[model samples]
Every structure is written in structure tokens, then in C-alpha cells.
Target: MARQSLAERRRQLTEAAIRAMTRDGVARTTTRSIAAEAGVSLSVFHYCFDSKQVLLESVIEAITEHYITVVKEAIRPRATLRETVRAGFQAYWDHVHAHPGEHMLTYELTQYALRQPGFEHLARRQYELYADTYTGLIEELGRSMDFELRVPAPTLARYLAAMTDGLTLSLLVLGKDAVPASADILDTITEHVASLVGDEPARQSTEVAGGTA
Candidate 1:
């Protein structure tokens, strides 16, 4: 195969690291194991990342991006506002359902980071990414659809992130057998969230055009 750029190589190793961490827990996964998982030499892994901490940071970012991309696409102003909201939630649920191990790894990474000295910031960054992701999605909807938030965008974003975090954790704790029941709860919460917004009148699209005009 041709040579991979440093960015490409880092991405390759990061993906491998995610898989390793997901399968073997953050505490169990090591630079050597990650290198092996990527089918590259340990020297190459060292060259790409300064330390395992850096590698973990990369994995944190990559995994967050992994799921948010799906939600972003899912929230693209669907046929109805409620449908759009449901799609975003469903997209997130689908990811957790399909990759339970990957989703579980996120919680593990957070706990691992918190317990490791000088690594607490990683846990903070992880949740911050969650809020930031929601902030972007909320803003995207504000720019596209007709609605105003019940609270400020940042507030709602964090709330959504926290709420989803709990929901996801409950799913993991309850196991796959509770899938049907969780869907009911998710649907109720999604509708309640949707109800909180969408009270304002007219298209958010026209508001932007009128302002920029």
C-alpha cells in the first residue's frame, strides 16, 4: 500500500484504538495493543502520538464525531418538526444499539479519565463535546426550521446532552431486552422536548433571508 500521511496514519491508529478500547476497556488497552490492532509497528504509533494520553484524546474526539455525524444528518429539517426531532434521537439510539460496546466505552473512558491524575480534563472535554455537538445541531435547526428554544441554545444543548447521557446509560444498564420499553420512554421525552420549542410562528428560513437581505 502507498504511504499514509501523518493525519491519515493518526486517524488509522485512532480508529484502531477505539476498537481496542471498546473491546478491551480503556484501562486494558495499551499503545502496543493499539499498534497491533492497527497492524502497524509500535514505533509508528509513537511517531503519531506523543503518549497514550494523546491517543486517548484522539479516540475521545473520533468516537464523538462517529455518532454526532449521524445525528446531524438525521436532523436536517425533515417533513415535520417532530419527525425531525425523532430522527435525531432515533439516529443516536440506532448507533448505541448497533455498537453497544462502543457506546459503553465512552462511559468507561470518562470514568477512567476521572480516576487518572492529570486526566480529569479528558472527562470534562468529553461532556463538553456532547454539549457542543447539540449546540451545533440546535443552531442548525434554528437556521433552518421554524421555532425558538424554551431556553437559551447553550442551556438547552447541555440539558439535551445530560438527558441523553442518562438515557443512554439506562439503556446500557437495562440491557438489550429493554429495547422496546426504552423506545417508549424515548418517544415520550422526545415529544416533550419538541413541545418545548416550535411555539414561535413562521419559517426560520425566511427570518434569515429577511435579515441578510
Candidate 2:
């Protein structure tokens, strides 16, 4: 269908933009490069996105959605809140390990947006979207476990955002060498999350190991 083709074209451009941004960095990624990466003409790229900013936003959305999906999938009802938290964090780390370039590109894009004056709002909105999604997950998990977070879910989400950013940056700098030591950080988070809940354990789900959420 024409509609499906149009959507596919847009998806292709978005993916191409992500690859270009990751490989070339924001400063060097131009419309022509992205169009070439997508195997489409510059006009087709323009048809999909009015401007580079729009394309960057689309790439951000895709990357963020993938992150949320993985984290949500990673968290499930477990024998203990600690295990649940560990699973989520570990899954997040796994995703970062698997897609280091995307993780790096995310921060690159955030910084790029921040420096663009008028486009700073895009960075803010991106983080807000992350915070909101993470907060909702925390609330849902808390309700399921009959335990509330020590801090507000939004506050905890913000804390998590900072933690993940640091962890990801470490990976970007140190590469795979950072993995073993990152366990200590994950352990600290698990202990903190465990402390938030009551003694009661959550009802374990039939499926463990964080099946798709």
C-alpha cells in the first residue's frame, strides 16, 4: 500500500540517520550522507523529514522506545525486589553492551540538541519522556509488590537516569573492560531498591528471566 510504503521510507530514513549520527557524529552528519546511507535520494529524505532536526528527533524516539522496551521486559515479579531490580538493571546493561554505538549516539544527540539553542527543548523533552516511562514502571512494580518506593517514583526515576548515564558513559570510555566493576554499581542499586520495600516478597511470575514485556 502507498501508506505502508511511506511509513517504510520514513523508517528507513530514521534508521539511516541513527547510523550516520553514530558513525560520523552530529557535526559531520549531513542530509546527503543520511540520504546515501538510506539508499534514497535527498528528495526522498526530505519527503520523510522536513529537516535534520526532525530526523534526529525520530531517531531519538526509536532509540528511547527500544530502551524502555528492554527495561520493562527485564523487570518482572521475582522472589525478591532485589532480584527484580537486578534483572532490570542487568538487562539494561546488556542492551548497552550490545548496542554501544546507539548508546553513545544517544548522548551525542542530547548534547548536540542542547547546544542548538532553540532545540534545547528537545533534549529536555527526551529526558522527561525517559523519566515518565521509568516512573510508571517503578509505580507498576511497586503496586504489584505491595511496596512503595522510599522516594517518589519520579525522583527515583531521575536518580536512575543519572546512574544509567554514568554507567553508559563509563562503557563508552572504557569499553568492555568496565563490565566486571559495573557489577558493584548494580549491586548498590539492588541494595537500595531492596531497602525501599517491605519484608514481603512479591508473587513470582510464571515466566522468569525477563520475558518481553
Candidate 3:
């Protein structure tokens, strides 16, 4: 068999670690288990990731990237900013529901990262990535309608990001009983944002006026 390249081995090991972490949580995941799950030897695991911290960090990065991709795909070229935001949140909830273990692992790692400065920096970077994605969308919508969004894009982005994070954590802690109401909550939030940004009718009128001589 051809020897696996270093990058390929690393990717394999990282994927295995994600599975283990998701199933076992960060505190319980170990190099040996991850290697076993990946069908790689201990030596191969070490070669790919020097330590548990490094492996976990890679897992966090991988998961964050996956979520960002999902969110972007959920919003891309959607009918309106409100629809895009709602779709993004709904997609996120669906993703978490589908991968409950991975979702829980993410929350666990977030708490762990908060206590360690190095990991905290990585966590903050991921948060910024999410904020930037949402902010860009909001700014684009604002420009299209020739309406200056009341909240600064970055600030609003952060608020929305934090809101989603908080909601996810709440769902995790409270389970389906508490989270089943999320649809209603999302509707309320959408209405509130629409009110602040001006209604669809107003935006449509502005667009029509801009098109006229």
C-alpha cells in the first residue's frame, strides 16, 4: 500500500479525534482511543499531533470550519437578509440536532478553552470568523436597500452570534422540552430585527424608488 502523506494522516487523525471527542467528551478522549478509532498506531497519532492539547485544538478548528461552511451555505443568495438569518439559525439547529454528540463536544471544548489563554485565543478567532460572516451579510443587505443599519455591522454580528451560542447552550442543558420553543423564539427575534431595520414594505418601496428616474 502507498504510504499516506503527512497531511492526509493528520486529516485522518483529526477526524478520528473529532469522533472520539464527540462521543467521549474532551476530558475522556485520549490519544490511544483516537488512534484506535482511526485505525492508526500510537506512533502515527503522535506524528500527526504531538499532544492531546494540539489534537483537541485541531478538532475545535475543524468543527468551527464545518459550522461556518454550513452557515454560509444556508444563507447564500437567499431571498432576503431576514430569510438568510432565519435560515442560518434553523440550519444550525438542525445540524446540532443531527450531530448531538459533536454539538455537545463543541460546548465542552468552549468551556475548556475559556480557562486556558492559548485555547481562548483560538476560540476568540473562531468567534470573530462567525461575526464577520454575519456582519458581511447584514452590510450587503443594508447597501442594497440604501438604508444605514441602525446597529454597527460588527456589533450586531456579535450580538447575533452570542445569541445563537447562548441558545444552543440552553438547548443542550435543557434538552428538547426547553428547545422545542425555539421556532417561536426565532420568529420573535426576526420580527424584532425587522422592526429595527425597517419593514419589508419600506425596503421594497425604497428599491422601487431607486429604480425610477
On lDDT, the candidate that comes out on top is 1
As for candidate 1, its clashing pairs are: none
Q: What is the C-alpha lDDT of each candidate?
A: 0.87, 0.81, 0.75
lDDT of 2 by residue, 1-213 (tens): 354487789888888888998899988999999999988899988888887677877888889888779888888888777888899989998899999999999888889899987788779878887787778888778777666456767788887788788888988899868887888988987887666544354323423424645
Displacement of residue 162 (Cα, Å) in model 3 is: 0.6
Q: What are the C-alpha RMSDs, in order, of all predicted structures?
A: 4.9, 7.0, 3.8
Name the best candidate (by TM-score): 1
Candidates by lDDT, descending order: 1, 2, 3
lDDT for predicted candidate 3 compared with the true structure: 0.75
> Taking the tens digit of each residue's C-alpha lDDT, what string does model 1 give over 73-179?
89898777888898899999888888888889999999999999999999998999889888988988889987777778888889999998998888888887769
Winner of 1 and 3 under TM-score: 1
Off by over 4 Å in 3: 116-123, 132-148, 194-201, 204-213
> How far in Å is the alpha carbon of 201 misplaced in model 1?
7.0
Error of 3 at 158 (Å): 1.4
Better candidate by TM-score, 2 or 3: 2
**Steric collisions counted per model:** 0, 0, 0
Model 3 sits at a Cα RMSD from the real structure of 3.8
How high is each candidate's TM-score? 0.91, 0.85, 0.78
